[model samples]
Target: MTNDENQELKRDKEILSHIQHRYDEEERRFQSVDTKISSMIGVLAVIFTIQASLFINILSNSKPDICLIVLFIFSLALYLISIYYFIKSHYFKKFSATPKPSFLMEEGAKKESEHTIVKDMIALYSDCINDNEKLIENKTNIAKKGFSFLIYGGCLSFIFLLCFLLELFV
Candidate 1:
């Protein structure tokens, strides 16, 4: 190949390699976001356990306010739905190395050409990368909703605690 042709081939190889790397990175990022969602759900579970204990303590007194019970129930339901969102977002396939072919077909006097196979593979890989980017975008939106639920649930819990304390003194 001439000097210009060689340079062009090298550039194409670099671009293809970059795309493969990006595909791996986006998949890894998806896993990271999914993991964060799961961890947040775990934290909510622990907080709910603590809140249950507080709720029990409040009932041991003369009488718990009906509003306090209602708010706690609402908070629990919100956390439950948020956990569902986080779990629902974990619906993507992980990318892995393609397996080596066990055998190959032969033409009248030759096997399949490597160039065509590689070109097709590169096209498929590019398409997968695009699809993965879209999946991650969706998961990110779901995670944001999960975060909003956690915040609102926390606020309701705080309000419950405040009301419980106020009733104790009154």
Candidate 2:
């Protein structure tokens, strides 16, 4: 190969390396989102447990206050919405992966020019990166909504606890 061809080949290799690195980074990012979602679900489970106990306490009272009952209902609704969103965010999403070694070998054998092979691989990686970006953004938005609802539900539950305490002590 001529010097110019050698330089071109080197440049293509570098570009391919960069794009592959980006694809790997995106995969890690996707996994990070999944981890966050799992943590949120765990927290939700704990909160749900606490809320269930409080609800039972309210019901067991001889004279349950209508106002408290209404607050509990609203709070319960918010918690349900939050859990729904969380589950949606945690739903399985198929992500594009890099080509397997066998596929790479096949492509290498079929392509006459290494440059063309590199270019094709780069294109594949780019497409996978784009697809993963969209999915990650969607999951993040849904998780944010779930977190907001969780906060709202938690605040209401706290208020209910305060009222119950006041009623009991005074």
> For model 2, what is the C-alpha lDDT against the true structure?
0.85
**10 residues in a row with least lDDT, candidate 1:** 99-108
Measured over all alpha carbons after superposition, the RMSD of each candidate to the real structure, in angstroms, is 3.6, 1.9
Encode model 1's per-residue lDDT on 1-170: one tens digit a residue.
Answer: 67986676666677778877887787688778878877887887787788777777766765887898898888877777777776676554444432124322322125445444445556766887777777788887887887788788888888888888898887
Clashing pairs in 2: none
Per-candidate local distance difference test = 0.72, 0.85
The most accurate candidate by lDDT is 2
RMSD of 2: 1.9
- TM-scores, all candidates, are 0.80, 0.89
> Model 2 over residues 138-162: C-alpha lDDT tens digits?
9999999999999999899888878
